[model samples]
Target: MTETILLTGAAGLIGRVVHHMLCERGDRVIAIDRIGGENITACDLTEVHRLYELAATVTAVVHCGAISGPMVARDNPFLIVSSNVVGTANVLELARVRKMRRVVCCSSVSAYGNTPAGLDLVPEDVPLRPTSVYGASKAAGEHLLDGYAFQHGIDGVSIRPAWVYGPGRTTECGIRTMILDAQAGRTTHFPFGCDFYRQYVHVDDVATALVLALDMEKLPRRSYTITGGSYITLAEVAQTVKRVLPQADITMGAGPDPIDDVQARFDISAAERDLGYRPYVTLEDGVCSYADWLAAQR
Candidate 1:
Protein backbone atom coordinates (compact mmCIF):
# COMPACT_ATOMS: atom_id res chain seq x y z
CA MET A 1 0.00 0.00 0.00
CA THR A 2 1.28 3.46 -0.90
CA GLU A 3 1.67 6.12 1.79
CA THR A 4 -0.62 9.15 1.70
CA ILE A 5 1.54 12.12 2.71
CA LEU A 6 0.76 15.70 3.75
CA LEU A 7 3.45 17.95 2.22
CA THR A 8 3.69 21.57 3.33
CA GLY A 9 5.34 24.48 1.49
CA ALA A 10 4.16 22.89 -1.74
CA ALA A 11 4.76 26.05 -3.78
CA GLY A 12 8.23 26.85 -2.39
CA LEU A 13 11.65 25.84 -3.68
CA ILE A 14 12.38 22.38 -2.32
CA GLY A 15 8.76 21.64 -1.51
CA ARG A 16 7.59 21.95 -5.12
CA VAL A 17 10.29 19.55 -6.32
CA VAL A 18 9.48 17.05 -3.59
CA HIS A 19 5.79 17.28 -4.44
CA HIS A 20 6.51 16.38 -8.04
CA MET A 21 8.87 13.53 -7.13
CA LEU A 22 6.43 12.01 -4.63
CA CYS A 23 3.56 12.09 -7.11
CA GLU A 24 5.74 10.65 -9.86
CA ARG A 25 6.73 7.79 -7.53
CA GLY A 26 3.00 7.01 -7.10
CA ASP A 27 2.74 8.26 -3.52
CA ARG A 28 -0.40 10.29 -2.85
CA VAL A 29 0.53 13.89 -1.88
CA ILE A 30 -1.78 16.43 -0.28
CA ALA A 31 0.24 19.50 -1.14
CA ILE A 32 -0.31 22.65 0.98
CA ASP A 33 1.23 26.10 0.93
CA ARG A 34 0.31 29.39 2.56
CA ILE A 35 0.11 30.77 -0.96
CA GLY A 36 -2.47 28.98 -3.05
CA GLY A 37 -1.88 27.50 -6.48
CA GLU A 38 -3.83 25.04 -8.63
CA ASN A 39 -4.04 21.62 -6.87
CA ILE A 40 -2.26 23.11 -3.82
CA THR A 41 -4.26 23.52 -0.62
CA ALA A 42 -3.96 27.13 0.53
CA CYS A 43 -3.48 27.34 4.29
CA ASP A 44 -1.12 28.73 6.90
CA LEU A 45 0.95 26.11 8.72
CA THR A 46 0.35 27.78 12.08
CA GLU A 47 -3.39 27.21 11.74
CA VAL A 48 -3.68 24.32 14.17
CA HIS A 49 -7.27 23.55 13.31
CA ARG A 50 -6.58 23.43 9.58
CA LEU A 51 -3.56 21.16 10.01
CA TYR A 52 -5.56 18.82 12.20
CA GLU A 53 -8.33 18.71 9.66
CA LEU A 54 -5.99 17.09 7.16
CA ALA A 55 -4.35 14.78 9.69
CA ALA A 56 -6.88 12.03 9.11
CA THR A 57 -6.16 11.96 5.40
CA VAL A 58 -2.41 11.52 5.60
CA THR A 59 -0.43 8.77 7.27
CA ALA A 60 2.73 10.90 7.17
CA VAL A 61 3.70 14.60 7.12
CA VAL A 62 6.62 16.32 5.39
CA HIS A 63 6.70 19.66 7.26
CA CYS A 64 8.58 21.85 4.78
CA GLY A 65 6.47 24.95 5.42
CA ALA A 66 8.34 27.66 7.32
CA ILE A 67 10.01 31.06 6.92
CA SER A 68 12.55 29.77 4.39
CA GLY A 69 15.79 31.34 5.62
CA PRO A 70 17.70 34.06 7.51
CA MET A 71 17.46 36.41 4.53
CA VAL A 72 13.66 36.41 4.64
CA ALA A 73 11.73 38.63 7.05
CA ARG A 74 14.94 39.84 8.74
CA ASP A 75 12.97 42.77 10.14
CA ASN A 76 10.17 40.66 11.60
CA PRO A 77 11.47 38.20 14.17
CA PHE A 78 7.88 37.54 15.20
CA LEU A 79 7.02 36.05 11.81
CA ILE A 80 10.12 33.90 12.00
CA VAL A 81 9.26 32.66 15.47
CA SER A 82 5.54 32.21 14.91
CA SER A 83 5.81 30.71 11.45
CA ASN A 84 8.88 28.54 11.99
CA VAL A 85 8.88 27.74 15.71
CA VAL A 86 5.19 27.80 16.54
CA GLY A 87 4.25 26.36 13.20
CA THR A 88 6.58 23.45 13.89
CA ALA A 89 4.98 22.93 17.28
CA ASN A 90 1.59 22.88 15.61
CA VAL A 91 2.67 20.24 13.06
CA LEU A 92 4.17 18.00 15.75
CA GLU A 93 0.95 18.30 17.72
CA LEU A 94 -1.05 17.23 14.69
CA ALA A 95 1.20 14.21 14.25
CA ARG A 96 0.94 13.36 17.92
CA VAL A 97 -2.82 13.71 18.01
CA ARG A 98 -3.30 11.74 14.81
CA LYS A 99 -0.69 9.03 15.50
CA MET A 100 0.95 9.64 12.12
CA ARG A 101 3.55 7.04 11.24
CA ARG A 102 6.32 9.59 10.62
CA VAL A 103 7.12 13.30 10.26
CA VAL A 104 10.19 14.59 8.37
CA CYS A 105 11.02 18.24 9.04
CA CYS A 106 12.81 20.33 6.40
CA SER A 107 15.48 21.92 8.63
CA SER A 108 18.53 24.13 7.97
CA VAL A 109 22.31 24.17 8.47
CA SER A 110 22.15 27.56 10.19
CA ALA A 111 21.11 25.71 13.33
CA TYR A 112 24.81 24.92 13.83
CA GLY A 113 25.88 28.56 14.03
CA ASN A 114 27.78 27.91 17.26
CA THR A 115 29.78 24.96 16.02
CA PRO A 116 33.06 25.99 17.67
CA ALA A 117 35.08 28.84 16.15
CA GLY A 118 38.10 26.84 15.03
CA LEU A 119 36.43 23.66 13.73
CA ASP A 120 33.94 24.44 10.97
CA LEU A 121 32.64 21.18 9.58
CA VAL A 122 29.17 20.64 11.05
CA PRO A 123 27.88 17.19 11.91
CA GLU A 124 24.44 16.27 13.23
CA ASP A 125 25.72 15.86 16.80
CA VAL A 126 27.02 19.43 17.18
CA PRO A 127 25.36 21.68 19.72
CA LEU A 128 22.89 24.10 18.14
CA ARG A 129 24.29 27.60 18.52
CA PRO A 130 22.07 29.77 16.33
CA THR A 131 23.41 33.21 15.36
CA SER A 132 20.22 34.67 13.90
CA VAL A 133 16.54 34.61 14.81
CA TYR A 134 15.85 32.45 11.76
CA GLY A 135 18.55 30.03 12.89
CA ALA A 136 17.08 30.02 16.38
CA SER A 137 13.67 29.21 14.96
CA LYS A 138 15.05 26.22 13.02
CA ALA A 139 16.96 25.01 16.09
CA ALA A 140 13.79 25.27 18.16
CA GLY A 141 11.90 23.19 15.61
CA GLU A 142 14.51 20.44 15.75
CA HIS A 143 14.37 20.40 19.54
CA LEU A 144 10.60 20.12 19.29
CA LEU A 145 10.98 17.14 16.98
CA ASP A 146 13.29 15.39 19.41
CA GLY A 147 10.92 16.08 22.29
CA TYR A 148 7.94 14.75 20.35
CA ALA A 149 9.79 11.61 19.35
CA PHE A 150 10.84 10.88 22.92
CA GLN A 151 7.48 11.65 24.52
CA HIS A 152 4.96 10.57 21.93
CA GLY A 153 6.82 8.07 19.70
CA ILE A 154 6.18 10.31 16.69
CA ASP A 155 9.07 8.96 14.56
CA GLY A 156 10.13 12.54 13.91
CA VAL A 157 13.35 13.53 12.09
CA SER A 158 14.97 16.65 10.65
CA ILE A 159 16.90 16.99 7.37
CA ARG A 160 19.27 19.97 7.71
CA PRO A 161 20.36 21.26 4.30
CA ALA A 162 22.83 24.06 3.55
CA TRP A 163 22.49 27.14 1.32
CA VAL A 164 19.79 25.48 -0.78
CA TYR A 165 19.57 26.69 -4.39
CA GLY A 166 18.08 25.63 -7.71
CA PRO A 167 15.33 26.58 -10.17
CA GLY A 168 12.10 28.18 -8.87
CA ARG A 169 13.90 29.89 -5.98
CA THR A 170 12.65 33.49 -5.65
CA THR A 171 14.87 34.47 -2.75
CA GLU A 172 18.05 36.55 -2.84
CA CYS A 173 20.69 34.11 -4.08
CA GLY A 174 24.21 35.29 -4.90
CA ILE A 175 24.62 32.73 -7.67
CA ARG A 176 21.24 33.58 -9.14
CA THR A 177 21.97 37.32 -9.04
CA MET A 178 25.31 36.84 -10.80
CA ILE A 179 23.78 34.62 -13.46
CA LEU A 180 20.88 37.04 -14.07
CA ASP A 181 23.30 39.96 -14.31
CA ALA A 182 25.29 38.03 -16.88
CA GLN A 183 22.17 37.20 -18.83
CA ALA A 184 20.99 40.86 -18.74
CA GLY A 185 24.47 42.21 -19.59
CA ARG A 186 25.04 43.89 -16.24
CA THR A 187 28.11 43.84 -13.96
CA THR A 188 27.68 41.93 -10.69
CA HIS A 189 29.75 43.48 -7.91
CA PHE A 190 29.64 42.45 -4.25
CA PRO A 191 31.25 44.51 -1.50
CA PHE A 192 31.68 41.44 0.70
CA GLY A 193 31.82 37.59 1.03
CA CYS A 194 35.06 37.28 -0.98
CA ASP A 195 36.95 35.20 1.64
CA PHE A 196 33.78 33.50 2.91
CA TYR A 197 33.23 29.83 2.29
CA ARG A 198 29.91 28.04 2.81
CA GLN A 199 28.01 25.02 1.60
CA TYR A 200 25.35 24.90 -1.10
CA VAL A 201 22.92 22.07 -1.79
CA HIS A 202 20.73 21.85 -4.85
CA VAL A 203 16.98 21.79 -4.16
CA ASP A 204 16.74 18.46 -5.97
CA ASP A 205 19.32 16.94 -3.60
CA VAL A 206 17.42 18.31 -0.63
CA ALA A 207 14.27 16.67 -1.94
CA THR A 208 16.11 13.38 -2.22
CA ALA A 209 17.25 13.59 1.42
CA LEU A 210 13.73 14.44 2.63
CA VAL A 211 12.29 11.47 0.76
CA LEU A 212 14.97 9.17 2.12
CA ALA A 213 14.24 10.24 5.67
CA LEU A 214 10.53 9.60 5.08
CA ASP A 215 11.00 6.10 3.60
CA MET A 216 13.47 4.77 6.16
CA GLU A 217 11.54 2.64 8.64
CA LYS A 218 14.16 3.21 11.31
CA LEU A 219 16.76 5.96 11.53
CA PRO A 220 19.68 5.61 13.91
CA ARG A 221 20.01 9.38 14.04
CA ARG A 222 17.17 11.87 14.39
CA SER A 223 18.83 14.48 12.16
CA TYR A 224 20.97 14.59 8.97
CA THR A 225 22.92 17.24 7.01
CA ILE A 226 22.66 17.51 3.22
CA THR A 227 25.17 19.63 1.32
CA GLY A 228 26.34 20.09 -2.28
CA GLY A 229 29.32 17.83 -1.27
CA SER A 230 31.78 20.72 -0.79
CA TYR A 231 32.29 24.14 0.73
CA ILE A 232 32.63 26.85 -1.95
CA THR A 233 34.06 30.32 -1.64
CA LEU A 234 32.86 33.38 -3.55
CA ALA A 235 35.89 33.15 -5.85
CA GLU A 236 35.01 29.53 -6.61
CA VAL A 237 31.43 30.50 -7.32
CA ALA A 238 32.60 33.34 -9.58
CA GLN A 239 34.87 30.97 -11.46
CA THR A 240 31.94 28.60 -12.09
CA VAL A 241 29.84 31.57 -13.26
CA LYS A 242 32.59 32.69 -15.66
CA ARG A 243 32.68 29.20 -17.10
CA VAL A 244 28.96 29.52 -17.83
CA LEU A 245 29.12 33.15 -18.96
CA PRO A 246 32.68 34.04 -19.91
CA GLN A 247 31.76 37.68 -20.48
CA ALA A 248 30.07 38.11 -17.09
CA ASP A 249 31.72 40.79 -14.92
CA ILE A 250 31.48 39.82 -11.22
CA THR A 251 33.64 40.89 -8.26
CA MET A 252 33.52 40.48 -4.48
CA GLY A 253 34.97 42.26 -1.44
CA ALA A 254 37.11 40.76 1.36
CA GLY A 255 34.51 40.05 4.06
CA PRO A 256 31.74 37.50 4.55
CA ASP A 257 27.98 38.04 4.46
CA PRO A 258 27.24 40.33 7.41
CA ILE A 259 24.57 38.15 9.00
CA ASP A 260 25.41 34.64 7.80
CA ASP A 261 28.81 34.05 9.37
CA VAL A 262 28.67 30.30 9.55
CA GLN A 263 31.65 29.56 7.30
CA ALA A 264 31.44 25.79 7.31
CA ARG A 265 30.79 22.67 5.25
CA PHE A 266 28.59 19.80 6.46
CA ASP A 267 29.53 16.17 7.27
CA ILE A 268 27.14 14.04 5.26
CA SER A 269 28.51 10.63 6.17
CA ALA A 270 25.64 10.02 8.58
CA ALA A 271 23.10 11.05 5.99
CA GLU A 272 24.87 8.92 3.41
CA ARG A 273 25.01 5.78 5.53
CA ASP A 274 21.61 6.13 7.15
CA LEU A 275 19.41 7.57 4.43
CA GLY A 276 21.44 6.40 1.41
CA TYR A 277 21.58 10.10 0.50
CA ARG A 278 23.89 11.34 -2.25
CA PRO A 279 24.18 14.84 -3.67
CA TYR A 280 23.94 14.63 -7.46
CA VAL A 281 24.49 18.25 -8.54
CA THR A 282 28.00 19.67 -8.83
CA LEU A 283 28.43 23.45 -8.50
CA GLU A 284 29.15 23.93 -12.21
CA ASP A 285 26.19 21.83 -13.33
CA GLY A 286 23.80 23.45 -10.84
CA VAL A 287 24.92 26.93 -11.87
CA CYS A 288 24.56 26.03 -15.53
CA SER A 289 21.09 24.60 -14.95
CA TYR A 290 19.97 27.63 -12.94
CA ALA A 291 21.34 29.96 -15.63
CA ASP A 292 19.40 28.08 -18.28
CA TRP A 293 16.23 28.48 -16.21
CA LEU A 294 16.84 32.23 -15.67
CA ALA A 295 17.51 32.75 -19.39
CA ALA A 296 14.25 31.00 -20.28
CA GLN A 297 12.37 33.31 -17.90
CA ARG A 298 13.67 36.45 -19.68
Candidate 2:
Protein backbone atom coordinates (compact mmCIF):
# COMPACT_ATOMS: atom_id res chain seq x y z
CA MET A 1 0.00 0.00 0.00
CA THR A 2 1.74 3.12 -1.23
CA GLU A 3 0.45 6.23 0.47
CA THR A 4 1.60 9.81 0.16
CA ILE A 5 3.26 11.08 3.36
CA LEU A 6 3.63 14.74 4.24
CA LEU A 7 6.85 14.91 6.24
CA THR A 8 7.60 18.12 8.13
CA GLY A 9 11.18 19.01 9.15
CA ALA A 10 12.80 17.21 6.23
CA ALA A 11 16.05 19.06 6.98
CA GLY A 12 16.31 17.77 10.53
CA LEU A 13 18.35 14.76 11.70
CA ILE A 14 15.51 12.24 11.98
CA GLY A 15 13.58 13.88 9.18
CA ARG A 16 16.37 13.53 6.65
CA VAL A 17 16.90 9.88 7.45
CA VAL A 18 13.17 9.17 7.47
CA HIS A 19 12.59 10.96 4.19
CA HIS A 20 15.24 8.85 2.54
CA MET A 21 13.89 5.64 4.01
CA LEU A 22 10.36 6.42 2.92
CA CYS A 23 11.48 7.24 -0.60
CA GLU A 24 13.60 4.13 -0.85
CA ARG A 25 10.64 2.03 0.15
CA GLY A 26 8.54 3.43 -2.74
CA ASP A 27 6.38 5.71 -0.64
CA ARG A 28 5.47 9.07 -2.18
CA VAL A 29 6.87 11.62 0.23
CA ILE A 30 6.13 15.34 0.04
CA ALA A 31 8.81 16.70 2.37
CA ILE A 32 8.42 20.20 3.84
CA ASP A 33 11.33 21.98 5.50
CA ARG A 34 12.38 25.59 5.96
CA ILE A 35 14.96 24.93 3.27
CA GLY A 36 14.05 23.62 -0.17
CA GLY A 37 15.82 20.80 -1.92
CA GLU A 38 15.21 17.49 -3.67
CA ASN A 39 12.02 15.88 -2.37
CA ILE A 40 11.42 18.98 -0.14
CA THR A 41 8.44 21.32 -0.27
CA ALA A 42 9.60 24.56 1.34
CA CYS A 43 7.20 26.00 3.93
CA ASP A 44 7.32 27.22 7.50
CA LEU A 45 4.70 25.20 9.36
CA THR A 46 3.76 28.14 11.59
CA GLU A 47 2.00 29.80 8.69
CA VAL A 48 -1.50 28.34 8.85
CA HIS A 49 -2.48 28.79 5.21
CA ARG A 50 0.78 27.46 3.87
CA LEU A 51 0.63 24.42 6.18
CA TYR A 52 -2.93 23.65 5.14
CA GLU A 53 -2.12 24.06 1.47
CA LEU A 54 0.73 21.59 1.64
CA ALA A 55 -1.08 19.13 3.88
CA ALA A 56 -4.15 18.98 1.66
CA THR A 57 -2.73 16.47 -0.83
CA VAL A 58 -1.05 14.04 1.51
CA THR A 59 -2.71 10.95 2.96
CA ALA A 60 -0.83 11.10 6.26
CA VAL A 61 1.60 13.41 8.07
CA VAL A 62 4.72 12.90 10.16
CA HIS A 63 5.36 16.03 12.26
CA CYS A 64 9.05 16.13 13.17
CA GLY A 65 10.02 19.81 13.17
CA ALA A 66 10.77 21.55 16.45
CA ILE A 67 13.34 23.37 18.63
CA SER A 68 15.11 20.05 19.46
CA GLY A 69 18.22 20.31 21.68
CA PRO A 70 18.45 20.78 25.46
CA MET A 71 20.90 23.68 25.24
CA VAL A 72 19.06 25.18 22.29
CA ALA A 73 15.82 25.16 24.25
CA ARG A 74 17.35 27.06 27.22
CA ASP A 75 18.69 29.81 24.96
CA ASN A 76 15.50 30.30 22.92
CA PRO A 77 12.57 29.51 25.16
CA PHE A 78 10.05 31.38 23.03
CA LEU A 79 11.16 29.61 19.87
CA ILE A 80 10.78 26.33 21.71
CA VAL A 81 7.20 27.11 22.64
CA SER A 82 6.23 28.40 19.22
CA SER A 83 7.83 25.59 17.29
CA ASN A 84 6.92 22.62 19.46
CA VAL A 85 3.58 23.72 20.86
CA VAL A 86 2.08 26.19 18.42
CA GLY A 87 3.54 24.53 15.35
CA THR A 88 2.43 21.11 16.53
CA ALA A 89 -1.10 22.33 17.12
CA ASN A 90 -1.17 23.72 13.61
CA VAL A 91 -0.08 20.39 12.17
CA LEU A 92 -2.64 18.45 14.15
CA GLU A 93 -5.45 20.81 13.22
CA LEU A 94 -4.42 20.72 9.60
CA ALA A 95 -4.55 16.96 9.67
CA ARG A 96 -7.98 17.08 11.22
CA VAL A 97 -9.33 19.58 8.72
CA ARG A 98 -7.78 17.83 5.73
CA LYS A 99 -9.15 14.47 6.92
CA MET A 100 -5.80 12.77 6.68
CA ARG A 101 -5.75 9.03 7.39
CA ARG A 102 -3.20 9.16 10.18
CA VAL A 103 -0.80 11.57 11.91
CA VAL A 104 2.48 10.43 13.43
CA CYS A 105 4.21 12.98 15.64
CA CYS A 106 7.68 13.22 17.16
CA SER A 107 7.40 13.49 20.91
CA SER A 108 10.54 13.24 23.08
CA VAL A 109 11.98 11.54 26.12
CA SER A 110 12.65 15.12 27.25
CA ALA A 111 8.92 15.12 27.98
CA TYR A 112 9.95 13.04 31.01
CA GLY A 113 12.20 15.88 32.23
CA ASN A 114 15.36 15.34 34.32
CA THR A 115 15.39 11.83 35.76
CA PRO A 116 14.41 11.64 39.41
CA ALA A 117 17.36 11.56 41.83
CA GLY A 118 17.77 7.77 42.14
CA LEU A 119 15.17 5.42 40.60
CA ASP A 120 15.44 3.84 37.13
CA LEU A 121 13.08 2.36 34.52
CA VAL A 122 10.67 5.25 34.18
CA PRO A 123 7.37 4.08 32.71
CA GLU A 124 4.89 5.79 30.37
CA ASP A 125 1.99 5.94 32.83
CA VAL A 126 3.99 8.07 35.35
CA PRO A 127 2.70 11.55 35.87
CA LEU A 128 4.34 13.97 33.46
CA ARG A 129 6.25 16.29 35.75
CA PRO A 130 8.53 18.07 33.32
CA THR A 131 11.45 20.23 34.49
CA SER A 132 12.29 22.05 31.26
CA VAL A 133 10.08 24.23 29.12
CA TYR A 134 10.96 21.96 26.24
CA GLY A 135 9.52 18.99 28.10
CA ALA A 136 6.39 20.92 28.99
CA SER A 137 5.87 21.90 25.37
CA LYS A 138 6.17 18.30 24.24
CA ALA A 139 3.76 17.07 26.91
CA ALA A 140 1.32 19.73 25.85
CA GLY A 141 1.65 18.69 22.22
CA GLU A 142 0.82 15.12 23.17
CA HIS A 143 -2.28 16.34 24.93
CA LEU A 144 -3.34 18.25 21.85
CA LEU A 145 -3.01 15.11 19.76
CA ASP A 146 -4.89 13.09 22.32
CA GLY A 147 -7.74 15.55 22.21
CA TYR A 148 -7.82 15.40 18.43
CA ALA A 149 -7.84 11.63 18.48
CA PHE A 150 -10.75 11.52 20.88
CA GLN A 151 -12.94 14.10 19.16
CA HIS A 152 -11.87 14.24 15.51
CA GLY A 153 -11.11 10.54 14.97
CA ILE A 154 -7.69 11.36 13.55
CA ASP A 155 -5.53 8.34 14.26
CA GLY A 156 -2.49 9.73 16.06
CA VAL A 157 0.66 8.06 17.37
CA SER A 158 3.15 9.91 19.55
CA ILE A 159 6.61 8.36 19.70
CA ARG A 160 8.81 9.37 22.61
CA PRO A 161 12.35 8.75 21.33
CA ALA A 162 15.54 8.73 23.38
CA TRP A 163 19.07 9.77 22.32
CA VAL A 164 18.78 9.26 18.53
CA TYR A 165 21.96 9.19 16.43
CA GLY A 166 22.92 8.54 12.84
CA PRO A 167 24.50 10.00 9.69
CA GLY A 168 23.83 13.59 8.49
CA ARG A 169 23.61 14.95 12.05
CA THR A 170 24.32 18.67 12.19
CA THR A 171 26.42 20.37 14.91
CA GLU A 172 23.34 20.91 17.07
CA CYS A 173 23.10 17.37 18.44
CA GLY A 174 25.15 16.47 21.55
CA ILE A 175 25.86 12.89 20.48
CA ARG A 176 27.12 14.09 17.12
CA THR A 177 29.22 16.72 18.88
CA MET A 178 30.79 14.09 21.10
CA ILE A 179 31.59 11.95 18.08
CA LEU A 180 33.17 14.97 16.37
CA ASP A 181 35.23 15.86 19.46
CA ALA A 182 36.54 12.32 19.77
CA GLN A 183 37.48 12.19 16.10
CA ALA A 184 39.48 15.41 16.48
CA GLY A 185 41.47 13.92 19.41
CA ARG A 186 39.75 16.46 21.65
CA THR A 187 39.14 15.44 25.27
CA THR A 188 35.48 14.48 25.57
CA HIS A 189 34.45 14.78 29.20
CA PHE A 190 32.02 12.21 30.53
CA PRO A 191 29.70 14.22 32.72
CA PHE A 192 28.06 12.51 35.73
CA GLY A 193 30.31 9.46 35.99
CA CYS A 194 30.28 6.32 33.74
CA ASP A 195 27.31 4.22 34.72
CA PHE A 196 24.56 6.66 33.90
CA TYR A 197 22.01 4.69 31.92
CA ARG A 198 20.73 6.47 28.82
CA GLN A 199 18.79 4.87 25.99
CA TYR A 200 19.81 5.52 22.36
CA VAL A 201 17.77 4.88 19.21
CA HIS A 202 19.24 4.83 15.73
CA VAL A 203 17.75 7.19 13.18
CA ASP A 204 17.02 4.32 10.79
CA ASP A 205 15.20 2.39 13.50
CA VAL A 206 13.11 5.42 14.44
CA ALA A 207 12.25 5.91 10.80
CA THR A 208 11.17 2.31 10.65
CA ALA A 209 9.01 2.73 13.70
CA LEU A 210 7.36 5.81 12.23
CA VAL A 211 6.49 3.90 9.10
CA LEU A 212 5.06 1.06 11.17
CA ALA A 213 2.97 3.39 13.31
CA LEU A 214 1.58 4.98 10.17
CA ASP A 215 0.64 1.66 8.63
CA MET A 216 -0.64 -0.32 11.62
CA GLU A 217 -4.35 -1.02 10.94
CA LYS A 218 -5.56 -1.31 14.52
CA LEU A 219 -3.50 0.58 17.13
CA PRO A 220 -4.27 2.39 20.33
CA ARG A 221 -4.92 6.06 19.82
CA ARG A 222 -2.25 6.91 22.40
CA SER A 223 1.47 7.63 22.63
CA TYR A 224 4.15 4.93 22.83
CA THR A 225 7.81 5.12 23.85
CA ILE A 226 9.97 4.15 20.84
CA THR A 227 13.32 3.70 22.57
CA GLY A 228 16.14 1.59 21.08
CA GLY A 229 16.56 -0.48 24.23
CA SER A 230 17.96 -0.31 27.80
CA TYR A 231 19.72 2.93 28.75
CA ILE A 232 23.51 3.00 28.19
CA THR A 233 25.29 5.48 30.44
CA LEU A 234 27.97 8.05 29.52
CA ALA A 235 30.68 5.63 30.66
CA GLU A 236 29.45 2.91 28.32
CA VAL A 237 29.14 5.37 25.44
CA ALA A 238 32.71 6.61 26.02
CA GLN A 239 34.10 3.08 26.17
CA THR A 240 32.48 2.29 22.83
CA VAL A 241 34.17 5.31 21.32
CA LYS A 242 37.50 4.09 22.70
CA ARG A 243 37.12 0.71 21.04
CA VAL A 244 37.09 2.26 17.57
CA LEU A 245 39.29 5.31 18.16
CA PRO A 246 41.96 4.03 20.53
CA GLN A 247 43.50 7.51 21.01
CA ALA A 248 40.21 9.38 21.26
CA ASP A 249 41.55 10.83 24.55
CA ILE A 250 38.11 11.01 26.17
CA THR A 251 38.18 11.67 29.91
CA MET A 252 35.63 10.45 32.46
CA GLY A 253 34.62 13.31 34.73
CA ALA A 254 33.38 12.91 38.32
CA GLY A 255 29.88 13.95 39.25
CA PRO A 256 26.74 12.58 40.92
CA ASP A 257 25.57 9.38 39.22
CA PRO A 258 23.04 10.21 36.56
CA ILE A 259 19.55 10.03 38.04
CA ASP A 260 16.85 7.87 36.47
CA ASP A 261 13.52 9.50 37.11
CA VAL A 262 10.15 10.31 35.60
CA GLN A 263 10.11 8.98 32.03
CA ALA A 264 13.83 8.37 31.74
CA ARG A 265 13.57 4.72 30.68
CA PHE A 266 10.47 3.37 28.94
CA ASP A 267 9.15 -0.14 28.87
CA ILE A 268 8.84 -0.64 25.08
CA SER A 269 6.75 -3.78 25.48
CA ALA A 270 3.78 -1.93 24.09
CA ALA A 271 5.68 -0.98 20.96
CA GLU A 272 6.97 -4.51 20.54
CA ARG A 273 3.52 -6.03 20.73
CA ASP A 274 1.72 -3.35 18.79
CA LEU A 275 4.12 -2.02 16.17
CA GLY A 276 6.71 -4.83 16.15
CA TYR A 277 9.38 -2.18 16.72
CA ARG A 278 12.64 -3.71 17.85
CA PRO A 279 15.72 -1.51 17.54
CA TYR A 280 18.45 -3.00 15.39
CA VAL A 281 21.55 -0.92 16.21
CA THR A 282 23.24 -1.14 19.59
CA LEU A 283 25.02 1.89 21.07
CA GLU A 284 28.43 0.49 20.22
CA ASP A 285 27.46 -0.29 16.66
CA GLY A 286 25.93 3.13 16.20
CA VAL A 287 29.02 4.87 17.63
CA CYS A 288 31.36 2.94 15.39
CA SER A 289 29.27 3.73 12.35
CA TYR A 290 28.97 7.36 13.40
CA ALA A 291 32.73 7.57 14.00
CA ASP A 292 33.36 6.28 10.50
CA TRP A 293 30.97 8.82 9.02
CA LEU A 294 32.61 11.62 11.06
CA ALA A 295 36.05 10.60 9.82
CA ALA A 296 34.80 10.82 6.26
CA GLN A 297 33.66 14.39 6.84
CA ARG A 298 37.13 15.52 8.01
Reference-based TM-score of each model: 0.97, 0.92
Which candidate wins on TM-score?
1
As a whole number from 0 to 100, the lDDT of residue 10 in candidate 1 is: 91
- For candidate 2, write residues 257-298 as lDDT tens digits: 443333446788888899989998877788788777878878
Note the Cα lDDT for every prediction shown: 0.89, 0.79
TM-score of 2: 0.92
**Candidate 1 — which residues are off by over 4 angstroms?**
none
For model 1, which pairs clash? 193-255
In model 2, the Cα lDDT at residue 63 comes to 86
